[model samples]
Target chain A: MNARGDTTRKRLIDATTALVREVGYANVRTRSIAVAAGVAEGTLYRHFADKRSLFYAAVLDRNAPIVAATATLPSLAGRGTVLENLLEVIRKLAQLQEDLLPLEQAMIADPTLAPLRGERVQMPLEGPPHDIARYLAAEQSLGRVRAECDPTLAAISLLAMLFGLAVHPLLGNDLAKSELLGASVSYFVDGVGASATQPKLLA
Target chain B: MNARGDTTRKRLIDATTALVREVGYANVRTRSIAVAAGVAEGTLYRHFADKRSLFYAAVLDRNAPIVAATATLPSLAGRGTVLENLLEVIRKLAQLQEDLLPLEQAMIADPTLAPLRGERVQMPLEGPPHDIARYLAAEQSLGRVRAECDPTLAAISLLAMLFGLAVHPLLGNDLAKSELLGASVSYFVDGVGASATQPKLLA
Candidate 1:
């Protein structure tokens, strides 16, 4: 596409995102999206296949930063202390979930978005959890982590903690913004068993 | 109310739960709920203030088992091994989250349910997380868990793990049905740090 076409496409995605946030996926109409983007209805179809496609594009566009941050997790495996690497992982995962959850909930509730759900392409062994697992496995090999621990399960546990915290407020509890992240990372790195004598790593 | 009134109210709640599960919350009508319950439309209103109230009743009805389970956690502290208590906690939390999440997403997406959202009564520092924290504190006092570990943060972390696993399938990832619950409980009871020399609690 030319520079003008690219600009129009970006505008459409931005408008769709804002409208979805304000109203909801079920109520958002393609015509209103075009109007919000200052483009013709015909132009929206010219750029994307359907409303679902356009919405998918908007979600992906919004998620680009998180994807980039998750991609960087594996490389940090042997470069830093495992505690430091996991703290960064938890921070990024929290941000990623916070951004994606509303959009995901909207998709689940809207029948029109069913096609997008069917088309969901999962990388399976290549998300943040998998990346963290790979990092832990590497750390285990380097003798930084316990040899008996299951890296995959540990990764899932870590991911679960962050995801749980992200959705806690939806259940009417206040978002726990205390020293939870640091404390969790510290607990994870140094086992909570009475015999485990590692000094406290986080304040 | 008399036995007949109790039976009628139970029928209405059961009908509402079935209908809401079949159709999204936005699409469910009180008229349909009454018909499904084999009662007059006036019957539903007589039993409840509005559709939101009926829906709330249904949610609470479904959640009673989880509430009962969560209520048992604090009393179990120091009665059995700390590991055994936590394993039970993870099991109950995972079940609670799995059942509550779909209803929650529907509530979040539908505008008519906005009033119900505001009416959410939280027990604040008295739910499962708090209960588990109390248990941990009791165990810490008994010298079963490390003194330096923060019980509140540790409780939060354990809850986060189970909640995360419950929601993982929503993102198109297959529900991880491996030995995750056992693994997480073991990790929580015994930290993953290299120097933590407790025997692995779970296989």
Candidate 2:
């Protein structure tokens, strides 16, 4: 596509995202999306396959930063302190969820989007969990993490913790903002079990 | 008030729950709910205030077991090992989320349910997080938990982990069922950081 086509495509995706966030996925009309993009309805079809494809593109557009950040995680495995590395990952995951969840919840709530759920937008290897698992495995090789711990499970646990934190406020509960991220990381690193005799390896 | 009235109310709530699960909440009609319950439409209003009230009652009815189990958490603090007590709580929470999440997603998707979100159906003290926090605090006082750990924060973390696990499959990801729960609890108790010389305190 030429520069003009690229700009038009970008506009369509941005409009779709805004409209979905504003009126929800179920109510957004393709015609309104074209109007929001300052294009004719026919022009939208020239750039994308359908409204669903446009919405998927919009989701991908919004998720670009997190996907980019996840790609860099494997390289950070042995570079920084494991605690610092995981903390950065947690913060990014939290932010990604914050941006994507409303869109995701809207999709899940719509039954038409059900067929698309089985389709893998991002490969398993490209996911944050996989990248984090790779990072943890590297740390384990360096003896920064426990040798016996399953990196994949740990990665999933960390992902779930961040996901849980994001969803908590949605359920009408308040979390203590001051200590949540740091404290959660600390607890994950040192554990809550009484281990006075154990040397704090991460510390 | 009478046995017949009680039976009718139970049937109405059961029908509402089943209908909400069968049809998405947006698609379910109060009339259909009454029909499913084998009663007249007027009968539903006699037992409950309105359709919203019937839905709320359905949610509460499904949530009763988890609520009942949460009430007993504090008493188990010092009796069994902390690990065993927590595993049971985690299991119950996972089950509660599995049952409640679909109805929750349905409610969140519909705009009509927005007003009810702010209402406190269950008191904060009666929530699983608060109960788990109390259990951890009791264990901390008994020297089973690390003295410096924050019970409330840790409680939230555990709850979040279970919540995260429950929501994972909804997004089309598969979890390793064999090791997930036990490993997560163990990781929470022992910390994933390498403590080569640390005694296995929880073990």
Candidate 3:
């Protein structure tokens, strides 16, 4: 498309993203989206076929950064402190889950939209988990993570913890900023298991 | 309600549950529900005002067992080996997340169902996380857990790992049963931090 057409399409998507975050995907309508974009309703259809299609563009297309960032995880394995590198990935992931939570909620409320979501799923084959697993495998090869550790399980656990933490606020537990920032990373890396530096207690 | 009335109600709910599982909340109409229940369409209205109410009965009411079972987590704190007891709780919690996944999907797809779900939320104040936290606190008091560990974080991590694992199949990763049972428990309890049992490397 021409630059002018690209500008209009970008405006509509931006407006739709805002509305979706504010009112959720189910409540998003073409007229309001067009109004929010400062364009005619006809303009929305010109850019996209329907409201669902527009919503997909608004959300899924924006996930390009996350998908790209996740693809780079494996390359960072031995570059920094394992904990630091892992935390950077975890933070991005938590934000991605948070960003997608609304879309996910909308999909759950109406399962018919799931196919559209499926079509937009980033990394449909393996996803961020696989990247983390591969990254951990690389780290393990470097003798950073435990030799016996299951990279897949560890990767899943890290993502799970971060995802859970991301959703905690929705469930009403206000995690201290520190909890979200360092706690899971510390726990995942160092674990809650006592170390020789700590006191040992009853078995 | 009378015994016959109760039986009919149960039958309707059972049918509705099956249909919701089969087609999801958005596609489940009152007619199909009635047909599945072996009752006339009018009988469905006698039992539920609309499809959403029926969906609640079919899904949320069935969640009573999971809610009640989760409430019992704190009681299991000191009963057996901490790891074993925690595993049983994690298993139950994982199954609950898995059972709720479809319902959550349906709710997200149609955000209008959210309020109905909110009204039906099993633990309105807090949720399984609180129970898990309480359970961890009880275990910590028994000196089974380290003094410095955070119970809430620990609880969240355990639930998170299970939840992430539970959603794995949805993402197309079929984690081995051994990974699900042993990995999180081992990580949470013993940690991956180097110990007298394992070699230490990084600073």
Candidate 4:
């Protein structure tokens, strides 16, 4: 926590970012990252537990936008219309996902990296969906969202849709992203039932 | 085209299955597959245009349950309750995805195998969603689904949820699969709107 230690942490993360961009995640190694950062290989172990944790820290630092947006989720629950708040969160998640695509592909390619992920393996399960579910539950308490609606499933559905939308372009599936998202969010908010009343989203 | 050619094609496919299972998709090569099948490496090119095509054919062959379920989609248009038919398709997709998980992970790991997938890259874009969209449109025509609903988005949402459910177990996200799925489909069919009428699904 000293200035010297903080500087070392920053240097290690920066080195990981540079090395990951240069060699790709599948090819990156702890010693190489240490070498790139101009530190002893043992220094990496001192600063971080493993390469996966190091990379996760780097990703979190890089994707501050999404992290910040997700943190503000509960505050937004009672403020804006539910659909608007949900869309905003999803939009941020999509942007973050777009940035993380290469890293995700690389991680999937390297089997050794999987077990190193440790606690981070459960991060995705606890991320935006968890926040969104909480937000929905809050809104339900406020009488904005339907009380009987299962917030967890709804949150998962929204998160899944956001993931699908984000990966669609990456996989060469051509979709009018913004337009389709608007429609999808509208559908989610209003439901597709014949008798369901559609709410007008704020501009 | 001839009996001899048919035998060769079957041999090549069988070879791919054995090789994929033995060495994994990231390690399988056309030459190794040919060597395993006791055929000239060039015989593989004659049977299939490339390794991706061969893998695609193998996946389709192995996933007969999903293909058969999908093929029966149109016949279910007005035959059963819309939710019943939709859940049936989703259940089949979940099973197929679970079966194909290893291959899917393997393919994601290997970059070289990507471009060879050709039109199959757009397979998800064209597969269950395409059929489901058509079925939903038909239901809309029959006054089952709301006419105002965007069938494409509905289909995509359902497909996305199905994919999430499929990958949840693979990624160690714990949810009661059937229960969560039932809630998801019900929410999709009835919407989360308090005013929406829910349908009774056949067991």
Candidate 5:
């Protein structure tokens, strides 16, 4: 990417994000994006051949915090108490999600965008869940998590806890964010048993 | 308060659900819904009183399975092994979420649908997560799950796990549905720790 190309790409992403915010997800189109970016349709074509490519780049660039967060995850995953490390990653993702609420809705709304599985989607700071899953698996072999525990499920569940809150923030249903998260972490660290491993976080 | 009223309400709900599924979430309208249900606009209002009411009725009715599962959750949240019991409730919700796919997408795409937060969104099951949450709290009091656990977060996490899978199905993500679900459940049961609590499934 040359300087000119880089500038054009950035402009294109900025335009798409703006359009998505101004109107709505389904209303966006290639021509509209190009026009918004103040470039000819052919110019957008030069940078990215189609609307889907443009959309993907726009989404990826718009959510840079996800990328940045994923980048530092491996080190975090390896350090700290395993539970602390996991919660930290979840919190980081939640914060990124809060910052990009519009894109999150757009991603969920567009069925075409659903193919971003672990291997295909490259957010900046992702890829460590796989390594963490493997590490957790090694521990299971040696009896860290329940010997019968599944690491992939653990990774997905952890991610789900964060995403769920991000989706629900003040949207309704009266669960205070901090209080809810405190409970979540406490529950996850130790089971919901009265007689458990750790002391009561809320108490 | 007779058969006529019952039929009218049913027609309105059916019409809304059909419209939501057919034209996508954004294009649905009161007039189109009235036309679909073969009722006059005035007649539609006589039953639903408003568009929001119609929408809520449709969402609630379409999600009968989840509602039913939720209502039944109290039975499972107590006295059993922590992870196993938790997984069973989550699995029940996952099955219920299959019916909620389109409505869930609509909520994401349109802010108008944001009223869902204030609405008492429940599984068709009488008291699924709420009951389960209460039960888990009791179990926490009784020394079943981790004493510090927030059953509320656990409950929400359970729903979101299925939702994440629903958004990206096994077919689309190149994963066998069963295999992915098994892995998902395992990870969820285990915290981000090296090992995790195992789930027990009873009813």
Candidate 6:
């Protein structure tokens, strides 16, 4: 990138990050970003083509590698117990910039953003379920996690718990909570499933 | 209760439920419910105190023990393997009347509805976390779950993933690909932790 282009790109991204954090994803736009950066609206065009493209760039810079590199690794392939490895991932994700939380979700959700989730951020091979499957497989091999257990469902339930902690603190709580921040990851590891009674079809 | 009181209470709830489903929570009010239910405006007052109280009553009805009892108690408490019990709870909760989905979130969110929560229902425990803690304790006591794990975080994470799945289906194609949901949960369940190689400190 040339000096002028590099300067423009930096300003554009800085403005986008600020606007998104100040307002929200739905409201952020190229025009506002350009104005915030004190650049001509057309300068934004020189830096990025459209809102979707700009938004994608922002997400890539902010969350793509951070979340992908960490979350999409061979996470399930831990030497320690499953709980320890899982807590490490949760803490890493929760600690990402608070500004990016809304943007991360908006990108992952919103089918409009689907095209952007491409070659740059390939999905991880050892997804949580795969890890659980590995764990369950290992445990089954060692005779711990029941072989008949639906590893997929177990994975889904566990993931839901982590997402809930993020959401409750972000969307529900009035003030940012330091104490509750790390609490969710810890609670899930304690393992609530083994004692749960068998569920029959509700008649 | 006299016939008039019984009829009035039923009419109010039916009216509010109908109104919310038809339009939305933001648009509905007692006057409209009263008009829809064919009760005089004051008749709405005779049965309910205000729009908040009326809406709270309807919200509770949708979420109350009668509807959830069909699944929550048995599934969460049952002796099934962890995943089986979770799937039972989620599947059943998914089957609840569509009106309830937004209702629970709206009541817990939106400060306008905060005061109403105190009036409509009292939680025996604060919320799902308590149920989660109890469940984890039981599992820990049974030596089924890892003793070192933090049950509270575990419970919250599970709740979060379930919430995302529930809302994801509403948000867009994210839910259509249960693969995404499954992957998310599975990773959380059996993911990696902070290590020298996979650092937790974010940029």
The DockQ of predicted model 3 stands at 0.34
Query: lDDT of all predictions, in order shown?
Result: 0.67, 0.69, 0.64, 0.64, 0.58, 0.52
Q: How accurate is candidate 1 locally (lDDT)?
A: 0.67
Write down the TM-score of every candidate: 0.81, 0.81, 0.76, 0.72, 0.70, 0.54
Provide backbone clash counts, one per model. Answer: 2, 0, 17, 0, 42, 38
Interface RMSD of each: 3.8, 3.7, 4.1, 4.7, 4.8, 8.8
User: TM-score of chain B, candidate 2?
Assistant: 0.80
Q: DockQ: which candidate is best?
A: 1
Query: Deviation in angstroms for B9 in model 2?
Result: 3.8
Summing lDDT over every window of 10 consecutive residues in candidate 5 chain A, give the lowest-scoring window.
A191-200
lDDT of 3 by residue, B82-137 (tens): 67777776666555555555564554445556664336354311467788788778
Please say which candidate is ahead in TM-score: 5 or 6: 5
Docking class of 4: acceptable
Ranked candidates (TM-score, high to low): 2, 1, 3, 4, 5, 6
Q: Which stretches of candidate 2 lie over 4 Å from their true place?
A: A1-5, A19-24, A27-51, A108-111, A116-118, A123-126, A169-178, A191-203, B1-5, B40-51, B108-112, B115-118, B123-126, B170-178, B192-203
lDDT of 5 by residue, A1-203 (tens): 89998998989888877776555566678899888888998999999977767767876775666655655544443344556655666666666565355555556655555554564654422454564566555544433345545676665545555555555423323323465565565445442122234342322
Whichever of 2 and 6 has more TM-score, that candidate is 2
Candidate 3 per-residue C-alpha lDDT over A127-179 given as tens digits, one digit per residue, 9 for 90 to 100? 77788889888877766676667888777677665554544324413333446
Model 4 chain A: which ten-residue window has the lowest total lDDT?
A: A192-201
* lDDT (tens digit, per residue) of candidate 5 on B1-203: 69988887888787777666565556677999989888899988877777767776777887776666556546554555656665666665666565555566666655566665456654332345566667566655554554435676666555555555555322214222455555555454443212234342322
Question: Which residue pairs collide, candidate 1?
Answer: A191-B191, A192-B191
For candidate 1, lDDT tens digit of each residue in B56-174?
78767766666666777777766766777778766655655555555655665555555443576432223777778887777776666777778888887777666656654434132
